[model samples]
Target: MPGPDDVSIRNLTQSPVPYKVLAFYKFADLDDCETLRPELAQFCCGRKIRGTFILAPEGINGTVAGTPDAIDALLDYLYGGAFGTRLAGAEAKVSWSETMPFLRMKVRIKPEIVTLRAPEANPARQVGTYVEPEDWNALIGAGDVTLIDTRNDYEAAIGTFEGAIDPQTKNFTEFKDYVATHLDPAKQKKVAMFCTGGIRCEKASSYLLAQGFEEVFHLKGGILKYLEVTPEAESRFNGECFVFDERVAVTHGLAQGEARLCRACRNPMPSTRACGAIG
Candidate 1:
């Protein structure tokens, strides 16, 4: 992480496009983003636009949406420096929508972007083995592996692998706590976990391995990447996929279209919307 004294405008100001921005970067100098947050708030507040950013020693992850012109200007300012350079390959998925996407812009400092309870798990560490959709299908069909849903209870309620075991976490950070206590004694069984993007599995899988589970695996690029590459109809993934964008939940079996996001959490609600028999 960058030293607190090193914070400056030249590092944390990189921006790429307008309307909305989504990015995830590995460990970086924290002072850079902290220094920029207030400046960003002021820059965005005056324009009546909101941008949300979360920064930490482990890196920064966030999405900010606003007017086209304002967004472009912000990106220009951000990308112009070294601190923001880490966002170079950051994923910025887009969609067409008419709703007011965000309520306001917020920038805060945290310990991690996708929180995992184990502070010892470093973002700089190498990741767990990733399984492409094709390989994933073959493995699941083999019937010797266990599929774990790394997302919260609600996300799994919407959709998941045919027989995936939901960790039922309130958030990703709680996942480590769940695994430490509940893993079955049959440790030889192959284990798999997945999330919207591949990042969460990176942390969760490693933490599971640390707990002595062997043959750990996770869906490479998570379900989002799977949808982009594999045909949804041919794949085992069922129901709607929750997205970070305004389109909300997308049907995995179909090409990209408007998502059916939950009004309460912005995650995609399943076609049945039958979470724990909420009815």
Candidate 2:
């Protein structure tokens, strides 16, 4: 199987795209987060890359955008340099945009990379079983499995797999309550969950296991990976996958989709709508 960097390069070179956005996350223990933040920020700053990176004692998570060479250099440092010692299972989801998606680079110390606010939610220690993209359809299609989208409400409003249940959450912090009220362990024997890049679901799956839910699973690389490998004809996804950048969303093959962000509410808008005039 191709590595994350290989996948990113393939997607970037396939078209005449100039800018590349690399979104990735990892769960690991970092005893030197205080020392690592500035070094990482300085590296990005010197290279003129723009994006946000959040570091915590638990791990690192964020997205960065720049030239293909610049991104490759960063990944080399991350996977083979000094920082590599403390990282594990790091994966990047690559997509293209006409313009730079972020204004500047930011590296900050946070309580958690993708905050669930649940003390028991520790992905570094434990997470749900990972279901590969190719096998995802059959797993979710199982009669006893409950499919759940672990993303925010705005994200799910634009696209999701058919038959997947949206928890209607405004943010990840509310996910615990949604699970508590909406999901019954007794009735839902096996649970399957997913998020944009897999970080949120990693934390969520861990939380569910802590809550005593049996047989929990999450999409290995979330929707982005699914879209990359699954052909449009075989795709169970109903619409474009909402993204955090200016591109708004992406469809099968990582192609930029038609949806744009509403300027006022930051919600997704159809291609025909005047996104700038929405405010």
RMSD per model, one decimal? 6.8, 2.7
Which pairs of residues have clashing backbones in candidate 1? 2-29, 11-83, 13-78, 14-78, 14-79, 15-75, 15-79, 51-105, 249-259
* Per-residue alpha-carbon lDDT of candidate 2 for residues 1-279, written as tens digits (9 for 90 to 100): 334455545445544777778886788887788989989999899988899999988888998898877887777767646576555448677777778989889999998998888989888788899999999999988888899999988899778998999999898999999988988888888999998889998999999999999899999889999999899999888888998877789999888899977768878867765655554
Give TM per candidate: 0.72, 0.92
Error of 1 at 200 (Å): 1.9
lDDT of 1 by residue, 1-279 (tens): 232212331243343423433333344555666676677677767766654777777676665666555555555545444455654434333222345467777878876777886855654664557787778888777677778889887677666777788888888878877777778537646888898777788788777666666788888767765765577667788766665655556555323444465555545565554333233
> In candidate 2, where is summed lDDT lowest over 10 consecutive residues?
1-10
Query: lDDT value for candidate 2?
Result: 0.84
Local distance difference test, each candidate: 0.63, 0.84
lDDT of 2 at 174: 93
Candidate 1 vs. true structure, TM-score = 0.72
Query: Model 2, 127: alpha-carbon shift in Å?
Result: 0.9
